[model samples]
Target: MTASQDVLGEVLADLRAESAELDGLVAGLPPTGWAAPTPATGWTVAHQIAHLAWTDQRALLAANDPEEFRREATKYLAGPDAASFIDDGAEEGARLPQGELLAHWRTGRAALEEALAALARGVRLPWYGTSMSAASMATARIMETWAHGTDVADTLGVVREPTDRLRHVVRIGVRARDFAYAAHGLEPPAEPFRVEVTGPGGQVWAHGPEDAGCKVTGSALDFCLLVTQRLHRDDARVRAEGAEAERWLGIAQAFAGPPGGGRERRGAPAPEGDG
Candidate 1:
């Protein structure tokens, strides 16, 4: 279901907050830092932000002119490797001077936000996967920004400040619980699963059947990191109860696309405050 105006406003606020935080992380980086390799294999800091800029521009197209967006997508799909689109685009974009890439991202995000706010109520916009409401699109944008920001932060040996804004990411993770199973060609369990995550501020955010037999519980940041595939589920503090919930945790994903071949065990250190 689409969020009401008040809820959408909150989501948009969080989206801007996430972008601002990421901007701070990359704003003053030297050329070396921009060229630094991130956790995403073969993607540098420039590649990461470049992808965000490209995506925001495409998402804005989806919001304003889906037909054109679909046509462009069809052209992209005709390429040999559909999965390599982001990688290829990022590599190309990385060729631009660092200042130009950053300026492009700032402009693209502003345009995307404007386009999203102008969307009519109850109207669904086309996306790479399922169509989405403006609220969902905004939330998805925030989730991606934050996830990529983590990679950039990690490469620089910096820690990002966490916030309750992650609740949007956690909500999407819970909602896509069944999709995770289906993406693996497994039938989602018939019964509902309970999810309880403690946010950064210690506020409890719960979803699903309040009395469901299955449950997943963990720190909200850990849950978000897991769903984004940034942290290996096994390496996270998140735990599950009941068979289906346990399996879901093993393959959970909030982002759209084929199930990601998630990050492997690297003895990766936990995010700030995760311990």
Candidate 2:
């Protein structure tokens, strides 16, 4: 579907809101806090923010100059160990001082916001995997911001509040069901499963055929955590009624990449959000 200005505007507004929340979370962090280890194994809080900043920079480039960005991506992919580029880039970025990294993140975020705003309606931009309309891209950015923001919150031992903002994230997660299976070199189930999430605002968000035998239902926050790989499926309240739906819960991922080894049930502290 073509992106309309109003839809894009709403997505952008959500993106900004997610960024503002994360910005507040880290604005007062001391050096030690920035270096504190998070649940993502080797990544510290600083690495989380740095990774977001680096991605924002790349997204800005993709929006403004697709051809140039593709050329660079091709070259980067041709490197002997190119699969490590994301991890390597995050490590390299994490070397900056906390203050500098925060500043860079803010600047990169603004640049990307501006670049997206300038795109014409219905415009699609190239990403690491497939292309996305401006609206879709904005939603993806919001999803990432929230996902990483949770890691930051976890590291600080702070609880975040659930908001209606998660609607965007949940939508992307449901939409990405097929992609998640494909990433694992497995064929997606032919039957579509119904998804019914009760959002924080008391709104019920439903997708797919309502009569589908397989179904997933639960709190929107839990579903978002599941799709983002932030919480183990066993730790979430989300229920999958059928085999296909259960499989989806086990392997769901919102962001594009190789199928991720999801967060383990290591007695990791549950994210302090809605149940």
Candidate 3:
């Protein structure tokens, strides 16, 4: 199998595992916890779960009608406080009963998987403002699941193991370095950088050139969590090898769109025993 396919397979596995974890967490949430506030401002656990379901449903629909998808998304954004509205949807999703919310999430996820599985290899699907193939789309989903899943896990004080599958999400974050740079009105780094993530069971996932001018080295989970802004930069588990690499490290983003609020560098110290 091709490297991309292998990476994609790992991503699919992560998605399934994350979905199961979310199911259990949501299912076990008490009614009050469902409405409890998450770290996201003004959002509750319910909103996050709901947003996932809604986004999956949208993805399934958009995969079949790219133009219409763009139009609808544009329209959605045209509304006043559209960004806040979208955030509200995610935060409010957990308001429903555990069973009902889980059912919706499962249904949307299944439809998305089916839609993606049916795509022809190399066929690009419209997303945000770019075109992505089935593999890329799947990887994006994996990143989203892992990033958002962190929020849920944090609220519940649950520590999740770093799976090898997170490599895909990390890769997406690495690839998006340019986007993040551009979002800040800065030019992207001229030279490519190396990314190394230490996975579970002592596995290491490396991307970009081996002798790249810059290097990002850390535990796979920490790297993923850091780039996604789920964890702060000073979390102490991630490290950079070059000045440019460290600059990119401060503003790394995996998801689409402009740079977000950005992340604070304050957190715990890096963990010992680098991968």
Candidate 4:
């Protein structure tokens, strides 16, 4: 297969694996379980999955009708309710019956995969703030699935085992370094920092200029948790070797949208191990 096709296949495979794992977590839950509050303030377990479904719908629209997607996006971004649109969409979906919501999420995910798979090479889909190729879109979906799935698992007192699928998340986190700075109105460092993390399979995954003085190193789980804002910087085990690199860790964001109010610094986790 061509390299581009290979990327599309690999990323979509990982996306399916990540989504299926989260589905397994919520599929068997009792109706009452949907109401369990997660770490995201005012968001329930149902809201988490609902948000995923809502975003998947948006992704499908972006792939199928970029012009319409842009029009809708511009309208939303200009409306007074723009700040709360994400919450509002999740709330609307969460109000459905548990079974109905589950089915909606499943259908949306399937439609998204099919739409993206049929796209031609070098096609770019417009997103909330940027555009991406089919493979990049799939990787972003995987990253969100794993991050939100972490929230759901935490709510249910379940500890999810980190998997190699996080390579996608890690890559996004590393690539988004400049976006993170720009989101916060700060200029990124002139030189790229070397990022090296131990992967789930104990393999070392590295990025950036090898000769750069700035560096961030940690377990993949720790970095993912931090970049996704699922874990506070104080609670993550990631290490930074330079002043700028350290500051980047403090503002790193892997997902699109506003700068997140990250989880509170709860010192209980003891910064010794990976999430």
TM-score of each: 0.93, 0.94, 0.87, 0.96
lDDT: the better of candidates 3 and 4: 4
Highest-scoring model, TM-score:
4
lDDT of 4 by residue, 6-108 (tens): 8898889889899999999999999889999878877889999999999999999999999999999999989998777888899999999999999999999
lDDT winner between candidates 1 and 4: 4
Candidate 4: segments with Cα more than 4 A from true spot: 267-275
Give me candidate 1's TM-score against the actual structure: 0.93
lDDT of 3 by residue, 1-275 (tens): 67766655655666778778777877877888777766555556787788788778778877888789888778777877655655655556656676788888998898888787667667788776467877788788878777777777878888877666677887898888888788678899789999887887788888999999789887888788777776667774878998999888788888875555534454533222100
Looking at model 3, which ten-residue stretch has the lowest summed lDDT?
266-275
- In terms of TM-score, how similar is model 2 to the real structure? 0.94
Ranking by lDDT: 4, 2, 1, 3
Candidate 4 displacement at residue 221 in angstroms = 0.3
lDDT of 2 by residue, 1-275 (tens): 34487788888988999999999999998999999988777888888998899888888988999898898788877887566777777888899998899999999998898889889876788887678988888999999999999989988989999999899999999989999898788899988889999998889999989999999999999999999998888889899999889988998999976665568675754342211
Order by TM-score, highest first = 4, 2, 1, 3
* Candidate 3: residue 154 Cα off by (Å): 1.3
Worst 10 residues of 2 by lDDT: 266-275
Instruction: Give residue 137's lDDT in candidate 1 (0 to 100).
Output: 94
